[model samples]
Target: MSLRPVVDEHECALHGDCAEVAPQVFRIDDVAVVIGTGPDELIMAAAESCPSVAISVIDESTGEQVYP
Candidate 1:
């Protein structure tokens, strides 16, 4: 899996929990959150810390998905 991060804008509350949980995977900017590498391990942490359950993790290489 190559790894990918999908954000649900409607579900996100801009709390920055994702960034806090995994800085390398999630970053907060002026407009929206972003993912740099989207590794499964880090992205998983971010998703777990997300209070709003807005972050979804996906593996592009293998199509392996992480459940939130």
Candidate 2:
């Protein structure tokens, strides 16, 4: 299944860890943004790596949260 990544702008600290872990999926500007759809593994990794826990991965089909 595919996963979609989202960044919580309020919680984001501009740490850039998410982008570092999954550059193809995340980009950092004034804040982090989802640049592309990523595989579940990569999305989870990026979400887990977020220092502020600002990233989340959701299952596209089930709408279930896959990562914190």
Summed backbone clashes in each candidate are: 1, 0
How does residue 21 of candidate 2 score in lDDT? 92
Per-model CA lDDT versus the true structure: 0.74, 0.88
Q: Pick the candidate with the highest lDDT.
A: 2
Candidate 1 ranges beyond 4 A from true positions: 30-32
Q: Write the per-residue lDDT of candidate 2 for residues 1-68, one digit (tens) a residue.
A: 88898899999999999999999988899899888876778888889999899987888889998786
What lDDT tens digits, residue by residue, belong to model 1 across residues 1-68?
A: 56677888888888888887778766777523675775567767777788888877777877767656
Write out the backbone clash pairs for model 1.
2-61
Q: How does model 1 score by TM-score?
A: 0.75
Root-mean-square deviation of each candidate, in angstroms?
Answer: 2.1, 0.9
- Winning candidate number (TM-score): 2
Q: After superposition, how far is residue 67 of candidate 2 from its true place, in Å?
A: 2.0
